[model samples]
Target: MPETARIRNVAVVGHRGTGKTSLVEALLFQSGAINRLGAVEAGTTISDADEDEHKRQLSIALSLTHATWQERKLNLVDIPGDPSFQGELRTAARVVEGLLVTVSGVMGVEVGTSRAWRLGDELGLARVVFVNMLDRERADFFRTLEQLRSQLSPQCVAVHIPIGTEHELTGIVDVLHMCAYASPEGAKEGEPGPIPDDIADIAAEYREKLLDAVVETDEALMERYLEGQELDAHEVAAALKAAVTKGEVFPVACGVATKNLGTHAVLDLLVEGVPSPAKKGSPIDVDGASTAVFVFKTVADPFAGRINLFRVLKGRVTAETTLVNLRGKGKERLGSLLELQGKEHKPALDYAEGDIGGVAKLKEAQTGDLLVDKEVAIEVPDFGFPEPVMSFAITPKTKGDEEKVATSIRRLAEEDQTLHLRRDQQTGEEILSGMSQMHVEVALERAKRRFGVDIELHPPRVPYRETIRREARAHGRYKKQTGGRGQFGDCHIVVSPFEEGEYEFVDKIVGGVIPQSYRPAVNKGIQEAMHHGELAGAPVQGVRVQLVDGSYHTVDSSEMAFKIAGSMAWKDAYMNADPVLLEPIMELEASVPDDVV
Candidate 1:
């Protein structure tokens, strides 16, 4: 295992289609982690390897991979940028100490970009913004940099600027070192050289701004800068690192992720600028000799069973370690620790503090659960999943497949916290809800492909009920004559609007008009009638019934006879009680464009 001081855990996050995945691939290739560069269009990128992700050409889940740069192990988490998959991004935020937010040079600022910035702020993560796609048409690095400064934070300043504009983007000028790195077509690392005379003026301007920002971290440096004292490059770099660790500055870099240009510089900056896990300090206090690990993501593989991916917050975890789940209050025996590379698992000797690893087939462990030593009790904060906005009723395509579909959905829900499943009691339909319609569709596709369960989706039905607005009284009687015995029963009931509950049945009989044992039978029959309402076959509610008087034959008027008489009396009173159908009311809030409104 790499030492905690040399391990840098960083998350690559940004808006959809901002080339986050491509940037990760470029970093991996530049670091010698992989010999060949992978492209998203070719579906060969290691991170976006899932079938659904390949079909959509977008990441739908969090991908974990690592690389060695300058002898420092960088654990990179490539998260999905689509809003529908924000849960994956939230999970990534919890484990990583720093964030590299990518902004498209052409698109500038977007909803996803803004959201990522806000989330990074909430998590208190040190951030480095990369202006990507500089080689694409209409891409402008300076314009995007200004947008970032105006919209996200004024502390955002460019440490590196593209040497040329779109179509002529061949190199980057490093403001800190006052040098340039130029690359030819299809090259991985650029050759360092003196800054071009044409770009030197602008590079100097940004370098001065960078120096000014870096000095703010120290009062002595700021005083030296005001007095026009020359500062060493190493001192400036040290101040920049200090400011970034405190979230006082967000260092900006530029690159074309698709072309692998400037990626080597990005890796260099990550190693030199971003803080290691040890430097960032532990998120929680680790005073005692206890172990604690937080499970951020759970994978439900059919063949492999449940795989738990967790980050060690304190102490050490090894094979055969027994940990207690604080949420479940149960003991868990950890068998083997595995290092994750996308979906592949490699055996790991142990996971030390500030390290992340995975284990297979954890029975009571799940996402957001904390596994700790029995002596320590601690609670980890959970990711706030957005409420589902779209819902659809799902049905099995074939009969007798309901259980299969349900089991599959439950398993998928275990993997994705954003997917919700519930049964509409009134409509008797299984409803699937998600962030969007496409989110639900992707979940269904996974269910079909992974679990071999086919289902049909439809709009969910609204549930309604029936209630009375007025009161009425009625008399009901039942008599029958057969061969040697005769059946006879009579009842009188008063029905009124009930304010306390759905329905209430009161027994009020005098002089043994109705037998004590038979009163309960009357209540049962009324309940049955209420369930199968008289109008629209909906359930009846908000009504009360009082059994005031009744008569019965001793030999023939049994519980069955009283039950039938009670049913008749309820129907007779309900018809005269002025009943009305009540539709379901939904309290909803929606956001719409002004023109549409």
Candidate 2:
């Protein structure tokens, strides 16, 4: 097992198209985890290996991988940038101690960038900003840094400045070291050199500002700086790490992830500046005796069955351990412990406290579940999943495939918490809802491809109702005189609008006018009529019926006869009692960009 102090769990998150995946790929390559760097456009990046994600050229799920840098184990989680996959991002945020938020230097601050920053603030995790895409045309690091200062926290200070702008970007000036590093095309490590003459003044200015920010975090350092003493670089570096851990400052770095430019510096900063899992705090309090694991995600592989990815919050978990699932209150036998690398898994002997690992085929365990020793019981808080905004009514393409479709939907929902499935009680349609149209569409595609279920999508129907407007009375009679035992029945009913509930039936007949046994038949017939309303064929609501008078022959008056009379009486009275169709009204809350509104 790896020592807790040597583990650095950080999540890479940002807006879509901001080079988050690329940055992760570059980090892996620089650390020698992968032989070659993979590009996002080619769908070969280790973080985005899902077939659907490859087809779409965007990340649809969270990817977990690890690298070793400077003898420190860095566990990196690459999260989807799209809002539709915010559930994955939030889960990643909860497990990691630090957030590496990448911002597009060309686009500056976008909506996703703001959201990523807010998530970090909410979790109180140490944050580091990477101004990516510096090699792209029109990319400006200083402009992006200014935007971060205004939009995010003003505590954000630059630790590294670009040597040039846009296409001319070839190197970066390390402000803390007061030196420049030349990064030619396709180079993994930049050559250290003196600061360039052109941007020397600018670098010095930012360096002074950085020093000012760093000194404020420590009183002794502040005194040294105020006394006209030059602060040592090592002292400043140590102070910067402390300040970052305390959330007093967010150090900014720059890189072009696609070209692997300046990534080695970023790795050095991560090892030096970010806190270990032990320092960031554990998800659960350590009780010293009991074992605890929090399952953050579940993957349903068609071949391997259920795979649960979890973090050991306390104690050690080995292959022979048996855990109790707090959510289900059932015993779960431990399978082989595994560590994940994209879609591949490697068997592990055990997972120590503060380490993240996976277990395959836990019968009763699920995402957000707490697995602990049999003697201990605890509930792990759930990641807050956003409400689904888009909805679609689904129909099985094959006539008898409804059950198959439903099973597929459930499995898919298990994989993605953002996807929701429910039967519309009013419309009687199986509805699938998600964060966006694309989210639902992708789920349906997965259902078809992964589970062999095909379905057609349509807009959900509005559930409407029919109600009575006024009160009216009518008499109905049924008689047959063709045979020896003829059927005969009669009834008089009064109908009116009701406010208490959907529909009510009352018996007002007296003196055996309607027999007590036959009254139920009359009520049943009227309820059937209400189900198929007089207006628009919608279900009837807000109405009442009263059986005032009725007559029946002793031998000829059967339950069927009375039921027929009740149905006829309801139809006559409903026509005279004015009725109207009521469409359902739903209150909705919408979120939009300020410019759109």
Candidate 3:
């Protein structure tokens, strides 16, 4: 078993195609966690296994993979950076203790880069930036570095300097150690090499900047640095770790993910430079007194049932352990704990605090559920994802596929929080809402592929309401002549506007003109009429109906007769009371292109 303190839960995030996934593959391969490195473009990478992801060549969900590098278990999560799939990034962010935010040297500071950085800041997660794909033509490390410093944070200082230029990218100098790792990715075939001469001056300059931040953490080091005394590599390493733990500095690391340049150096930093859970802070609260475990995602598999991906925030969770799901308000039994490799689940018997795991067949579990011991209950803070801005009206193409559509949509909603489905009340349309047009399109595609359900989508309809502009009185009389008996009833109602959302009915008939016993029947009839609107056929709200006068025969005027009379009178009053159509206007907040605006 790996030491719980030695475990590092880090998520890699940035804009798409920044080599974030490739970095994880390289880390796992070089660490011997996998026999061979898988390429993302070839769709052979372990973490990019979803058909939708492979087809689009873009990750649609969070992928968790693990590897042991130098006896330290690194739980790496590669999160999709697209705004449409941002819920996945938020899910991964809620669990990981640190963030390895990747930046493409060519793009420098991008919209996604800022977004990932903001997410990390919101979670208070320790962060390290890797300027990746430096081997690509036009990849500018120094330009990206300057942009990061200007935009991300001034504290984002480089600790390692790239020794060669783009396309000629070779290795990096560990400014803290004054030693060079020959591999551009880190740790070549044999022992580490000396600093490359070409970038020695650049390395020295960054070394001073790193020391300036690190020395502040220790009084002795501060004095030595003030006196212009050079600290040894080990001292600098210890101070850098302490500074990073305290968030005084975020040491920037650079690498070429495909060429394996600084990948091993990053692993070394995780083991030797990152802080343990104990040093970081307290265990996350479960409900009241118990430890908290948040299930950030749920993956549905037809053959395997479901895999609930969770982050153990406080205590250890073992197989067969029963826990409370605050979201479901029910107790769930953990069948088995597993580690995820993209969509695949590897069974495990135990999971410790701050580590991510998948519990198979958690019948009552869903994404955003806080699982804890039943005796102690606590709410986990949830991530804020963008609300869906567009909607689609969808229906099953065939009667046989109706149930399949519902089931598939429910599963899709579980996988992507921003995807929502509901029956629109006004138009009676089955509406699907998502972040964008593409989001809904992909949802339909997934439904067909996963559940074998075909659906047709249409534009959603707007809801409209009806209201009265002027007060009016109405009287309805219903009389029935049957061969054996007869029915008779009469009612007088005054229709008027109340405060919006306030619906009231008062029995104002005096001297029992309409018997008190039958007045309830009259009000019930009017309320029922209000549900299916009088004008534009929408639910009527915020109106008042008063029973001012009515007449009834105890034997002839039954409840049914009174009900009919009330409906007739209300509809009569609604049509003649200056009724007008009121369209339902939904408050919208969206970020669109300035040009579109």
Candidate number of the best TM-score: 2
- Write candidate 1's Cα lDDT for 193-270 as tens digits: 999999989998999999988888789999999999998878888888788878898999997887787787788777
Specify the highest-lDDT model's number. Answer: 2
Clashes by residue pair, model 2: none
- lDDT-based ranking, best first? 2, 1, 3
Query: What is the Cα root-mean-square deviation between model 3 and the actual structure?
Result: 4.3
Query: What residue pairs clash in candidate 1, if any at all?
Result: none
TM-score of each: 0.83, 0.84, 0.82
Find the number of clashing residue pairs for candidate 2: 0
Question: Stretches of candidate 1 above 4 Å error?
Answer: 184-186, 284-289, 300-305, 465-597
- Residue 415 lDDT in model 1? 79
Off by over 4 Å in 3: 135-152, 161-173, 178-203, 217-220, 281-283, 286-294, 301-305, 312-339, 343-354, 359-387, 411-418, 468-502, 506-515, 545-562, 576-597
On residues 497-549, what C-alpha lDDT tens digit does candidate 3 reach at each position?
Answer: 88776788988888978887788888888888877776767777667888999
How does candidate 2 fare on TM-score?
0.84
**Using TM-score as the measure, what is the rank order of every candidate, best first?**
2, 1, 3
Worst 10 residues of 2 by lDDT: 588-597
Lowest lDDT 10-residue stretch of candidate 1: 588-597
**Residue 45, candidate 3: how far off, in angstroms?**
1.4
lDDT of model 2, residue 579: 84
